[model samples]
Target: MTRDLLSPAHTGCLQDFSSRYTRTCRLDAEQVQSLLYVLGTTLKANLNRSAPPKTKYFSVKCTDNVQYIISPLPQASSYLSPVRLKDNSVLLITMKEASTQENDNKLSVWYYAANKKVLDKAILHLTAVDISLDVDADRDGFVEKNNPNKNAWKWGPRGHGAVVLVNCDSETLYRRKPDYKRERILKSSDVKDMSPMVLRTKGPPKLPEGYKLVLHISQSDGENIRVFITSGERYPLVLNSEVLSKEIPYLGTDEIMFYVEGVSFPDKDFDGLVHINLSLLEPIGEGIPETPIFTDTVVFRVAPWIMTPNTLEPVEVFVCSTKDNYKFLSSMQSLVDRCGYKLNICYEYMNRGDRWMQDELEFGYIDSPHHSFPVVLDSPRNGKLDDFPYDVLLGPDFGYVTRVPSRKDVSSLDSFGNLEVSPPVTVNGKHYPLGRIIIGVAFPTASKGRNMTKMVQNFLWAQTVQEPIALYSDWLEVGHVDEFMSFVPAKDRKGFRLLLASPDAGYKLFKNLQNDGHGDAMLFEEIPDQDSISVNEILDDKQLQAENNYVQSCIDWNRDVLKRELGLDDEDIIDLPILFKLLEYRGQYRAAAYYPDMVNLIVLGRNLGIPKPFGPQVNGVCALEQEMVSLMGNLGLTCTFIDDFASYHKLLGEVHCGSNVRRAPFDFKWWNIEM
Candidate 1:
């Protein structure tokens, strides 16, 4: 029977049995022979007792329903018998009686060790099913379980049978077979963990008041990390931490933290967000990758304290009151009243021949008053003068009375007979050492070569103070820094903006007027009939070429120096179109004068006081005044035009020199500021 079952002629039968069982079963020839012998003996015994004398062989019919239901049970089942083969090996076979409902109709063909100790050490391989096994080692009531999610098989208290079962859902069994194979492959492969995690941060949404802002960073084990805050390109605030000495903080581990310090609200109202950036750098010797290792930005909203300008003490306007300037006093007084500012009229009188009350000579210049004064919260000089000294005066005859409070003290003179001492000027309740600041001087040819020794000494003195004085061309009769450049509060309220006189724009206006045939009128209208000359007579082509070259050189030099000193860009400057005229001074030497001196306008807080240009109208318009007013309006400034043609402009002076401002003290401590 074993030979017949193993023959090629019975291959179809074997396949049919396997199909019905729905599982593959491997059997040795000995096990097949035993099964056949048991069936044969039982059939012969039953047939002999029931059949008549003619019944030599018994016939059996296999029904499809019975065949399908009578499938093999697991080898560990109690009904399975162990056959000891002639080779001394045991073959476990499930009997037909083992196919019962209690078995869950599951065919468990895999074998297991009967001994509890042997079964405990045995390995059971499975794909997706979570498996478990239990053994009663001492025949005790307690059964030890393993792999709890898998089916459990209970051995009798005597530890008679050892069972193994694999349980899993149909979907998991089908899906996880490939995954299990891949996991085996992965475990065998030698691969390094090269991918590092990104840096992350957890912190408060808003910064706390009067306390350091703390932030926690997720652990970055091996990479170098850096963090900082930025407001575009301007470096204003400081970022400090134990790990950093500069703006960028470097960290070896994420456990360390950093903070921002010296952060203050802007002078004006500002509500916005600032970005904090975290950067991670790859380990050294790791070549540059296609992209940066890691970069992340976190935004935080800021609400800073609000402050208003001090109103108890307002800015003051100072003007020289030489005898000739007395006529314009009423207009100045009216302007002060309208703008709600205090007016200080310096009445010190001085005579320097015919040009004594010239605006450039008398007014004097103050560049940055904030840096010059000492701040005090409460005092008579809360924002005003501290002390006035006489020996420190700049000059004697050069002093217009409004400039000098003491006349009896004569200061030592330089080679050109110019006073050499630096004076103390009072503004906003504080006194500044004028000697320490570099003063801009414009010495005419008469004063230049006449006293080279004294001039060099003055220059050395200026250098010794670490403030190299700026010396512009003195071609103009009233050449002065105030005549061409003035400082106005910036729109952002951070600092002041420099207002420059744009000669290029002025030349364009002149060209336009000339093309329209109004050039002669602009040149001759201001002069008397006897003295009037045509534009051509005043400046031939050769003279005009020289003048253009001179003006361009002056403009370029001034612009470059101002930008270097003030750290200004083009955006920080406002250019006002202003034309210059060549004129004979005392019929001996030639001099230049700005036709309108637009930059010479006065600033009173947010308001401006400008001079109304008085000259020939071009194309039915006073182009200078029209342009100045239009530009001021566009700048968001309220302007008041005061007529200074007869009083100031005719004397080679303009509005700024005729008046000054003791601007309001800023709320911030200037001394604490880093330059």
Candidate 2:
């Protein structure tokens, strides 16, 4: 043995024993026996029989007349295959080299004092455990540093690193792995099968229409669970989990409570398909000690509040009442509240014979913008009152307003009378510039013992004009303004459009003529001649029974059929039938009205028949109940009957808001439809 084996400078690769080489390398059974025999003989001939030498052990054997020791030559396993091996040549040679005791360390060294033949046999048993030709430490450090994509030696229970040791393979090095993706989190969440995840004794009874689920996480304390939703967005939510958590702990408390809101999306993807997915983020188990696990997998979409054309806006609408018809007013108020908008209502005085009262009443009572609700309110200008009662007929005005005066009145002077007097206008107790006062008259109060049918005719007259303005004699006594009124411009009064019905055939006509192609005919009130018509005439025996059946069917659709099938409550299913019947009724009116005037409009406008300008309104109306059910089947939908413009706006707002999520003020555009 020599000191070279222990020298750090003479390093060689013997780290991994299994991967590089195995137990059997160079000799057969007979060859090994013969080599061992010859090497034993040589050791006896060279060294003293009684004296033994001290050196690093390689492989040694002593027999009857011979002593043998096998030494790894400097070449060792590094020797490349020679052109050929001579017979009994020393591939596994046994050699007896002298030993130096200066450095006897852990490194394996060769033994001296052995015959070549005997040493060869001992070396044959020295199987190549780990034989590498590197001969240097740095050359075989880590394989991971060179190849990133390859799997490194990992220490986990399921990987190869578990079975391998550090010294086994010197070339392999370990690296980090990626995070696991299992589930997702939603912005606007949906609990499709909520029963399993949370304690849903009744499963929240399916979310109602125009309502959405907003997530509110609470810590064990009364405070909300604060988290940064956006990396840089400044706005943070201050949720009161007390309302959402109820019996549960605060967000990230002992357990975080998730408050979910119901919502839906239409055409959310490039394929024009509607879909829902969860909102997700890599949650850090920082504040909470334990690993946070979602008890329920929610279906949520990002709901961004924005100020766009589609985004909701609040408006205060003024409505008048006569003869204690507060039902209409109350209904309208509820509608506005439900639609998620603000409404302002105020009653005013109208002529006994004037058609303004009823028109105002209907305007005040709009189920939806599609269905006319005439309401009158004083317009506000620059934080000041413009007039006491300037009529504003608003709804889904497809385009512009067209006003036509029907007749004249002797007592009329408001247009000039009100303007002539300089009244101090005060809004919030502040005086402002005075403008021309216009006397807005809502004719024919359904109350006040006036004919309801005649009231509708007045509204009809106002809607049927093509020009921006019109003047006419009160041949029908529709309004006294017809007499003195002239040069009144059309103001796009969609609010004034009312669904009128006569006692005789009004209901049938109104129901049938909903989306008729004839603008003029459609403009005619269902109860065109109220004096001669009766409710009995319109819904006579058989017709009344049919209406009853239709109503019953609608009720069933909402209660029995819809609720049971969709797993909705009674109230949620109730509104669908009412709207459906209303649709049926309106459809009939439209069909009946179209035949007479359809030809004329089709001939005149040529390409532009009875303009389908009512697309949004009509779409909104059609989407009323059934559309909601179809849209949000998993979440239930039902309607609350809207009575006036205020409620109608609210409903419209809620509907629009509930349909899709709006991003930031500038993030989204009409062209961009993200769910």
Highest-scoring model, TM-score: 1
TM-score of 1: 0.38
lDDT of 2 at 579: 14
Predictions in order: lDDT = 0.35, 0.21
Q: Write the per-residue lDDT of candidate 2 for residues 1-675, one digit (tens) a residue.
A: 431121122223222111211111223322331211111112112111211243111232332122122222333442321111212112121222211221111112123333312222222222101001110011121211212111122211222210100010001111211000101222211111010111111111221112222233323211212211211222122223343222221111011222221111111121111111111122234564322111221221212111111111224333334344355456545655554544454343432211122122211111110111112221111011222223223212110111223333211211211111011122233321211121223322323211213222333322211001111111111222211111111112210111111112223333343435221221212222422222233234465545445433322322342223223332222121111112133223101111111101110000111111111123234212232234223332223422222221112111111111111122212112211
**Model 1 clashing residue pairs (backbone):** 316-662, 346-402, 348-401, 348-402, 349-401, 383-428, 383-429, 384-428, 384-429, 384-430
Clashes of each: 10, 78
Evaluated against the true structure, the overall lDDT of model 1 is: 0.35
In model 2, how large is the Cα lDDT of residue 392?
A: 27
Q: Across residues 1-675, which tens digit of lDDT does each residue of candidate 1 receive?
A: 121111121223333332111221233211211111110001111112222223222222221211111112212332233211112121211122211121122212222233211111111111111111122212222233321211222222322211111100011222332111111112111111000112222222211122121222322200112233332332222222223323233221222222221121111222222333443322233353322223333332221111112111336665656546554677778878887888865555322222222222212211111111211111111111211111112221111111221222211111111111122222333332222122234443445421212333332342221223354535455445556666555455324466777767666665666677766745435434324434344334556546655665676677786665544577767777665656765653433444547677777766777766544466666666677767767667777766665567777767764664433433432222221
Candidate 2, after superposition: displacement of residue 584 in Å?
11
